[model samples]
Target: MLHNFAGNIEMYGILDAIASGPIEALTSENSTMVGVGMSMEGIEQNPIVYDLMSEMAFQHKKVDVKAWIELYIARRYGRSSPLIRDAWNILYHTVYNCTDEAYEKNRDVIVAFPDVNPSLISSPLEMYPHYGKPTSRRAILREKKNAYEQPHLWYSTSEVIKALELFIASGKELSASNTYGYDLVDLTRQSLAKYANELFLKIIDAYKFKDVDKVTSLSQKFLDLVEDMDTLLACHDGFLLGPWLESAKQLAQNEEEEKQFEWNARTQITMWFDNTEEEASLLRDYGNKYWSGLLRDYYGPRAAVYFKILIESVENGEDFRLHKWRREWIKLTNNWQSSRKLFQVKSSGNAVSISRSLYNKYLRSES
Candidate 1:
């Protein structure tokens, strides 16, 4: 995100003066919120600008509105032009008062034009503050009730699907030129090849027979097939396939590729803890290689806490430690528990002693 705030600050001051309100009230002190709102405003005004900003925002997780406006004006007009500030002011006022009525009135013009003032697309909903002084529990519950009582603004599932179909059809029609058709075909092929290779590897891994020779032979054949597919992919000189084919070819040639591939393919393997020696042995082997390393690298100080849970599960011979270490890992990673749950190894034991020791180690490390 761009941080050139000079323009925004000047704009905000002017806005504050017009309203005769505190300047700080017009602008958020929170940098992230300000950036998000400004970026969204910038995008809504111009679809081309919106497309670029949205892509950058989704990838980089932030946007600088002032810098973007400055660059945008310089590109469209000229560098160090006075009209830049004037145009920005006009756009700002338009966006500041943007409402549902305005959107309805201007919808046709916005859809038909390449350049749009951001205000034309602004939604009042986006202006709502995300955070502020804490409210009482009762007030919060009341707010929730009021929200639920209001008509739902989001599209239903079926409506969304229909909308997506329309979008795809429109995109295809718009890009029906020979050049674009070739690009689309190459993109589709590359995407299919990538998915197919991933699915093939997954199928091979799912067969748990410890026959190393068979697995190795099948893996080698799969790799060869992938290489051949990539070779065919390279014949398509479209932009979409060029980058993907190049990457796949590099992967095929690189000797150290396997290690990188292994890392990419690393997935959690869940084992239910049974007190049997056989279960213990399997758990130890798998845990040491995959689970232990993941926890240490990702969780750092809390790694030992996860390790303790694994040990405890095994010692107790319990069918499963419900939630257990895998749950904590999900919390730390802030990801869905689905993948982590797959790797859950359930074992029975209230290994308080082990947990205590690990907790102490974590504390010491933190200190």
Candidate 2:
């Protein structure tokens, strides 16, 4: 079975569930397996999550994450020790082990974009049907009260930052060995995203305070992280957009068919499932991926547009026109070839060692 069926971040344990089968059925000897479908991208994001699940299938055992991680660290890298286990402990209890009820708002950086103005109903990361359409003034007043509720408030901010550092250090420890390249790429991707999430919240705070200079500075930095993320993911063949697009192209017999197939591949990782134009937003960003081309080409431009509006609105002393922007965003979401910008097809630097030291630099209070 899978989690996040509604299409946001699922717990890292769904990997475990896939291997464990139903709790009642665990007593039976029947064969069970998981497809982990719609995962056309790289295996880099969460190898540990799935590796544990795979072992669960054969061992048919429950995970004492504490104990299992020791073995995991040893196997993935060439070594393991107290440092390794300590880091995994933090992840197991927090980000990896949360339930929907307990951590309702804990979301990725991109997913929390709507917090800037909860009334907007959609972030630049997505184009929700409710975003462009007009709503009553009563609804606006309601959102004003709740807009402060953001996903980043899920964990002890300092602790989460520490866990991200742990991942980066783990990447460094394993770099020279390079025992499992997939794990390296995945760790870097996670570190980059965690760092971005931290900055994302700061940007929102800056905007709240009308710190235009801070907004402009942090906005550029956040986009830089997104761009760097694309570079990191490019190390893996599965994370490259060229092959992803080509896979779609191979299924087409004509130019019209080609366009449709391309749209299918792109949407599968984005909006997901089949929906009409009016209902084009079901599960938006639910399956969001940071593939080579999608990050630099698709997500980057969207962020640029958002910060531009914020900076301009602040400069001119006028309110931001989110609806107008949403209309334009909707148009881009429909088109596959919004630009011809070239993106890195291969990763630069050692994805592991290069991202190694980021732990100290990013993990801290926002002071």
Candidate 3:
């Protein structure tokens, strides 16, 4: 049997749930086995969640959390230092320190569909359909306010920047460690992901004011950052979407089977299910990812379509056509989901170098 405590971020409470069992249910003749599992919703981008889970397992089995962290640092970098520990402590208190009421993981604006006026909608229909009366719109809007976690930053971005700085400072000592390299890239990725949300808000503001030049320029920078992020993630095998889809194909014996499996794999992460005119797949983008090829191809194109339409509307003196944009967006998403294009499965580039370059390019202080 599996126990699900994945929604809330209460680590200790989850551990307690894992450790506790039904009374009068255990005996020498019958044993109960429980497993702890994490959702893949954002796991690829948040490796620290795995680390947290491992810490939970160790704590549940009579190991101290502090000792586990120390050992983890040692094994992760083949050595530990005040710099590393200090950096990790900041991370523990900030990004890793989710409140009990917070979502399982933080969400990113990149995964959210672009809106001229951003508000979390209850149903896809309300956003796309104009036939609904004001009363019906009000009802639909209130329907799913808390259905799932919305995109939010629970911690300070400055603190995350400090953690990234510490990681970069320790690079000379841990450069040769693959685990350290992964952590470096992952930390940088996290830092920039948070910053991307800021950029997105700016984009929304520019769109709101109908600043054609500012919108055009900001959109380029946003897409460029997405491309750079994809490149950085492609440096690690764990961050590639290619191997994921390729593995699905490899499992098939025949070409027809391979095509089916590949389609299924793509669909699972993209639409979740087919969307219809009257109903939008509420689960669409629930599996939104930060994987390499996916960012460049899928998410990037979707945002590009949004910007293109927005800019055209401003130039042509037309109202932003929500339904038309949604139709175009769906077509773009479906084309990607159904395409047979294969992405590179193997990783390339140097993680440390890429991280440093990005730090200088995006995060370094000008003063």
Q: What lDDT would candidate 2 get against the real structure?
A: 0.55
Instruction: Report lDDT (Cα) of residue 124, candidate 2.
Output: 25
Q: Write the per-residue lDDT of candidate 1 for residues 10-82, one digit (tens) a residue.
A: 0111222222222233343653332222322111122223334334423332344455555654444334244
Candidate 1 is scored at a TM of 0.21
Which candidate, 1 or 2, has the higher TM-score? 2
**Relative to the true structure, how large is the alpha-carbon lDDT of every model?**
0.28, 0.55, 0.65
Give the higher-lDDT candidate: 1 or 3. 3
Span of 10 residues, lowest total lDDT, candidate 2? 126-135
Candidate 3 per-residue lDDT over residues 1-367, each given as its tens digit = 2212222111111322223222223322565635445544223344444665544433434434455566778877899988888887777666555444433433565765544323232232322232211123233334545433434445556766787888888888998887887788778887777567667656656766778899799888888988998999898887788988998999999999998999888887777665874245766765666678988988888889888887887788787777777888788877787899979898888887788788888777611
Rate residue 297 of model 1 by lDDT.
31
Ranking by TM-score: 3, 2, 1
TM-score of each: 0.21, 0.70, 0.78
Which segments of candidate 1 are over 4 A away from where they belong?
A: 1-51, 54-179, 182-186, 193-197, 203-208, 211-221, 235-367
